[model samples]
Target: MNWKNTTRQTLGTTVLCLAALAATAASAATQQMVSVKGSTLNMRSGPGTHTEVLWELKRGYPLKVLARKGRWLQVIDFEKDRGWVARSLTGSTPHHVVKSRVANMRSGPGTQHRIVGKVEYGEVLRTREKRADWVRVERDSGKIGWIAKRLLWGW
Candidate 1:
């Protein structure tokens, strides 16, 4: 084979390899939602101007993007429910959950305080801190409160 012809073939092959690598890198750069904030987000059946509403998502909601088409994103929520939504409405904050049955979350640390909420087993809880047996938690709508230490998983 001529040296000049061999050099051109090698250069062409290298360019193709580099192009494939760049495409893979670009695919991996898309941002993922670490958590969901606010009261709730609406999930729609399809992307864009016309779609049916499927479900509502509360705070600390988690989702994985399956694909993206223009300004809309196809995702699977924490419940593994698949749907589409506007890409600008999601966030990336960490979340946790309660690990015990009938966990009492109170207004204060001591048992003397009023019971503010009752967290069931496997219920998700956003953690803040711990004071003795109390674990501070933040609700999906930004409600700050405390729960018993025996009630949570991430503590």
Candidate 2:
């Protein structure tokens, strides 16, 4: 038997398996909502409180998690702001952000309904309800309206 040949084949197969596992993990990155849990959540330049504070976030803010380390998470918001936040401040609650330059907010779940208002690009909305292709949402200012699901990210 060729021992060297067997070892080489086994090593190649292990490398391939590790590569596949990495790809799967990359695709599984979860989108979640920032729930500061009372005290304001501080976003830092790095993964620890000792790092510089980039900004502060309130509860229910939405973010897409790109990576995690210990108790910190690297996140991006609707305005493309990127920073590190404490993992304890986030949850799996679904949220959406306006992707279009201006999303027309209708009174109801369809275009036939009255045009209630408009939201600029990067505006974040909390998911209240969903009906077919439209999602009912409430803005930071407490304005409620419906927007086409396709016009936003995170569904």
Best-performing candidate as measured by TM-score: 2
Q: What is the TM-score of candidate 2?
A: 0.69
Candidate 1 TM-score, C-alpha based: 0.54
User: What TM-score would every model get versus the actual structure?
Assistant: 0.54, 0.69
lDDT of 2 by residue, 22-70 (tens): 9887777654445444346888999998899998876566777878899
lDDT of each: 0.72, 0.81
Q: Model 1, poorest ten-residue lDDT window? A: 29-38
Give me the displacement of residue 84 in model 2, in angstroms: 0.4
Tens digits of per-residue lDDT, candidate 1, 42-150, equal 7899996478889876766656677888888888754557898777776655555665657777888878988887777656677677788777888756666788776
Error of 1 at 107 (Å): 21
